[model samples]
Target: MAAEMTVSELVRRARDGQARALGRLISLVEDGSPRLAEVAAELAPHTGGAQVVGLTGPPGVGKSTSTSALVKALRASGRRVGVLAVDPSSPFSGGALLGDRVRMQEHATDDGVFIRSMATRGHLGGLAWSTPQALRVLDAAGFDIVLIETVGVGQSEVDVVSLADTTLVLLAPGMGDGIQAAKAGILEVADVFVVNKADREGADQTVRELKYMISLGRREKGPSWRTPIVRTVAARSEGVDELVQAVTDHRDWLIEHGELDARRVQRAENEIQAVVAARLRAEMGELRGGATLAGLAREIVDGRSDPYRAAEQLLADLRS
Candidate 1:
């Protein structure tokens, strides 16, 4: 804990390329400290520049491997990279279970790469509760690219798409993931389909199935930027450059079509809503001392008021 540094100092040092300062800032957000507003103020002007890319898929799809491969490619091109690997929280401890730094030890010594594994902490959709704020930290730190890898919690993990400019849905061969991916509603959100472990026997089948499935649907995006499927054996770092190139192409497309700003605006909107919701929850807890929501629940339970009416009364009270 960098407890000695004030919020302003942390923001200044982080923007100056101090990794420790940036790490502390992210921790502050994860812990939901009151100083978060100050941190946000410091970061607001510097954000929305980093290209956020989201990678998600079923378990065993090699999302971490692909992320590491992409980091290598990005670093080789002199781009500073930030990787956020969201891992499941331990039930008792609330700590990240799978330490992503271990898998990405290859970049451990690279000053150009910063990787952090965040605990999902019972948050659903395979994202950390503090992911948006943590991303703002990385963006304000002047990273050229940010790679977000989800907790691999199956289909409901599309929340990453809201925050990323380009979302990669990865599938491994022979896992029945192709059908599951479609069932998970992942087919619609993927800007890029990554077939990992491409050297495996079912790789061609996976790619073919995805292409066929993609052909059956029409994108609402105007001007026709067809999503590309990139094949990679991430363990060997093969096809990573092509994947990176595909991401670059998508970023360029977003910029040209003015979708980048649109996405960022949506991202900020989501963040603000989350903040307001959390604050309301805190306020509701305080109101518990006065039997507000509890009183409403009792009224509903005793048949004195319907749930909808009780909810309306609670909203009226909150506004008052």
Candidate 2:
């Protein structure tokens, strides 16, 4: 724990391309280390400047290809981009294959583009526990745009909504039942929708269905943002420019309505609460000891006590 490293030294080392320093800073934030709060307080002012975009969709929707294309386009326009591809950890092995990184190899040597693969680490909310910390590191490192590509596990992926400045949901043609399965939460959180593999049959129908769903859920003055369905063949780099323009338009709209700052405030509040919850759980576990908690859990499961009552008793015991 290099707790003595000053913010300036950390920032300088991060800028000098020290991956370990960057990783450590992110780890501190994710683990809710005391120093993380101090570092975040110092770095908060530097955030809200980078455009954080989140991309999520069903598996095999070509999200990585689209992300790569978008990153390339941003770089061509002289913008530095950072990409965080969140992959699900294999339950059997407890490791991530990181297939997204493999797909994004085109930019491997580009200093302007920094790409990192993160595991969801069994977090239930469709986001990696370390995601917020990673984004902060990217912001501090002076990236103009930070793109977060999710694990693409359907509805749980809504966590990205609270974390990103703009959330683009990617869908492909011929999804059939998969589209219906994701319609409830995934459809509502998206600020922009991309229909990748547009050259395939049923692309237009997918777009129309998505638009109808959006229209049905529309509320006057409720977020008041139109979610546009842009077609793209990301593998071939088709419609990449239009997709970029749509993202820009949505971001500009956010800026115009003052929602950008409001959203940032909400995200900060969420981060603080998450950190608090995590810390409380850790401290409580340490105080109780793992064996005690395990015994309590077993007792509850055996119907010795109801879960809610057992929780109350534990709380009372802790307070005492």
Candidate 3:
């Protein structure tokens, strides 16, 4: 469908708030279309405006519920919101499982809200590889806020930090989340800790544990933010306004300390590196099936040549 529209035309329409055009542009990004570079070129100037927020945690922490509540809160303030809910891929379809999409259907008819479910496609980082590019599409489409809800938190899921301006790590009372947070290194990446399902028992204990951990973490010798913990029963949208305020406060802190620019610069660097890596992989596709690489592998396996020398030979052949 995107093939029917020129990248410039799609970008223009998306900026005009045409939902279909915005969806098409994101689809182009998701599918890694040949026109993706052109789409990026058009989107580049219009970006760096939206506040990117990431919500992540172990599964069943009400991340989807919290995201929905946040969208409601943002829309009440008349800010256009974009949500990227990265879902685990369906084994048969290789597409989003649509769990988040199903839960957030209340906003489906809200013109100010755009919710997209992205399949991780087996990406280890709990995000679709195309997510940064998708964020560009949303930013260029004039969203005031973008919320990225990762597939789930794990050792490898903190990659969201590289993209978000404020990362809200959600935890539930009964989930052993405090221990999991410590194991996953989430304490380092969390800008705000949200204990969703706060009405449940053990909620206070979770909060206490988080505050203790926060106290233990060392901070840089400069203006530093003591991460705040907010409690919420996301199912009822309770405490969501306070959660929103916490995010705003964190954003304010980021701006006041001149850290927003620094973070964005780092984000751009990560995006650049990802692009370069993807390009290299594409260029190396030939070596994957070519005799040069196979020969190198055979040599290494047969002990005829060391792995380092075989790698060197493969690179040399690739160069030629």
Candidate 4:
């Protein structure tokens, strides 16, 4: 049997830059370990130092390539970066394909970078259920910047806005992505709008369409800030410096406008609410008979009891 380790050892080793230990801590979080509470309490003091930035968009928008480019740019400035690439889960085993990790192999030997791929496990909104806790592990491990790359789920992917201090929405030319973006409500969530693959033919037209859409005031994301449009050919590393600068500018703007603290507070609030909901779900599942839930549904379907009353009965059973 493997030796049991203490939370202190894990925390200390992870903070000292042991990538294996850090990965183990994140696994503990993902597995919902019994010692998770202890680990979280131990790491609480070390977190809140890293900047959490989320990159999200429709599928084929070059999020992974852009993330790798950003890592190269940020590391050039002497910052330690961590990447959380959330991928769609396999239906059979619920495991991630880890495609992003493979794409980011150039950084495999770089000690300053850590890349992890997580499975969404059928979770909608492009993020895994354990993602917030995993992010905490990265934050506590002393990463200067944490980039969360979500699965490409189109409109429902707005949950990243709640988790990230800054959200970058990427689009590409030749995809009719500008119109699709407006229809999908993607424009409202962007702190920086990146037009990746800018070498394509419709690049200028896409930029003009996005600018026109932004000017319509359909989504008022900032009262004092204008979300800047950035062009980048991430595969060639073209415009990456400008993209990174745009991200930096947005971070600075958040600090200046008092939105940083407010956003963090909101993130904590969301985490707390999600935890409570999950706990309640588990608690409700512990009712005396597992079939009681199905029985309740059957009763509702048979018109013997309405859904409102059936839900009340479930709560009553829980209280008892």
In model 3, which runs have C-alpha deviations exceeding 4 angstroms? 88-97, 100-104, 122-128, 219-222
Query: How would you encode candidate 3's per-residue C-alpha lDDT over 1-320 as one tens digit per residue?
Result: 65687899999989888888988998878777788789999999999999999888877788878998999998998999999886543435645545644755687677888888777553222243588889999998899999988855454356655589998988888886566657766667788899999999999999999888877866341278888899999889899999999999999999999998999998888788788767655555567566666777788889899988977776676678
**Whose TM-score is higher: candidate 3's or candidate 4's?**
4
What is every candidate's alpha-carbon RMSD to the true fold? 2.5, 3.1, 2.6, 2.3
Clashing pairs for model 3 are none
Name the regions of candidate 1 deviating beyond 4 angstroms: 88-101, 122-129, 152-156, 288-290, 301-304
Expressed as tens digits, the lDDT of each residue in 156-199 for candidate 4 is: 35665568999998889987655566676667788899999999
TM-score each candidate. Answer: 0.91, 0.87, 0.91, 0.93
**Native-referenced Cα lDDT, model 3:** 0.81
Task: Tell me, by lDDT, which candidate is best.
Answer: 4
Q: Which candidate would rank higher by TM-score, 2 or 4?
A: 4
TM-score of model number 1: 0.91
Worst 10 residues of 1 by lDDT: 120-129
Candidate 2 vs candidate 3: the lDDT winner is 3
Which parts of model 4 are misplaced by more than 4 Å? 1-3, 88-97, 121-128, 154-156
Clashing pairs in 2: none
lDDT of 1 by residue, 95-182 (tens): 4534654654677678788888777554322243488889999999999999988854543356655688998988889978566667
Query: lDDT by residue for model 2 over 108-155, one digit each (tens)?
Result: 677788777666554322243467877988898778899998756644
Model 2 residue 283 CA deviation in Å: 2.0
